[model samples]
Target: MTLTQHWKEIVNLVTQGQRSSMHCAIASVGDDGVPNITPVGTVFLRDDHTAYFFDSYTSQFAKNVKSNPNVCLMAVNTKRSFWFSSFLKGKFSSAPGVRLYGTVGELREATEEEKSAVHQRIKPLSWTKGSKLLWSDFTQVRDISLTDFRPVQYPKMMEHLWN
Candidate 1:
C-alpha cells in the first residue's frame, strides 16, 4: 500500500484509540558506533497527527533523542477478531527517523477542550498502593512531524484478529 495509506491507518488507530501504546525507537551512535533502540510507553495525543509520551527525567531514550534527535515511532493493533489473522503483520513506522527528528516540543497549557478530551479518554490507571500511572506533569510534550509511513507486512495471524 501507499505510504499515505499507511499513515491514514495509523492516524485512524490513534484517533480511534485502537492502538494503546506507541513503540518509539531511537537509533543513536553509541560510544562504540552501534545503534541503540529504546521503546517507551506513550501517554498523550494532542491530535490525530500529533502525540506525546512520558519518560523518566534521566531515561536513556530521552538522552538519546537529545543527542541524535532521530527517532521512529510505531503503533500496531493486534487485537483483531480471530478471523482476521492474516493482517496481524500490519504495522506502522514514522519513516526512519525523519518523522520525529529534532528537539521535542515543549508542553504548553492544555486548552479546556484538550483537557476534556484527555479526561474522556484516560481515567487515571491506578493499579497499586504506590503505583500511579506516570504522566509527564503537563510539562513533557514532544512534537514529531510526519515524514512518511508504511505498513510492514501482512500475516495470517491478522486474520484471526481482524476476522
Candidate 2:
C-alpha cells in the first residue's frame, strides 16, 4: 500500500509497538551477505514518509547500512493485555505487527531541534538511572525512506475478525 495514504495508521502501530516493546528490529545485510538484526529504541517517524533513528551504540548496524542501504524494520505489539484480549476474542482487532521496508540514508549529525525532540520523546524516563546512560551521546541519525509496508498476518485467527 501507499505510504502516504497509510502513514497515520503506520505511525499509530509503531507508537503502540514502542509502548509495548520499547524497540523495533532493524534488519540489514552485512558485508558477508548475511542478515543482521538490531534492536533500536530511538526510532521516530516524521510527517514525511521517512523515519530516523539514533546511530549511537550501533557500530555494526552503521557498517551494514554503509554497505547496503536496503533494510527492513519490524515492530510488534507485545502487550499482555492486547494478547489476552485477542486470545479471548479468537482474533486480533488490529494488526499484531508491521514491517517497513526502506533504504537508509547516510548518517549525519542531529540538529538541535532533532535532539530536543528526542529528549522530549523520552522525558518520561528521565528519572531512571539508565535513561541518561542509554539516551545520551546520540549525535548521528540515519534517515529511512520507507517504500513498502506489510502487516503481519495470521490467516486462521483473522479469518473472521474483519467481518
* Residues 50-130, model 1: lDDT tens digits: 555544442655555555555555444443442154334353222111123323444345555555544444445534343
How far residue 79's Cα lies from its native spot in candidate 2, in Å, is: 0.5
TM-score of decoy 1: 0.55
Winning candidate number (TM-score) = 2
Residue 88 error, candidate 1, Å? 11
Q: Scored by Cα lDDT, where does model 2 land?
A: 0.87
lDDT of 2 by residue, 51-160 (tens): 99988877788889887999999999999999899999888888888899999999899988889878887899977889988886778888999999887789777765
Point out where model 2 deviates above 4 Å: 159-163
> How well does candidate 2 score on lDDT at residue 144?
95
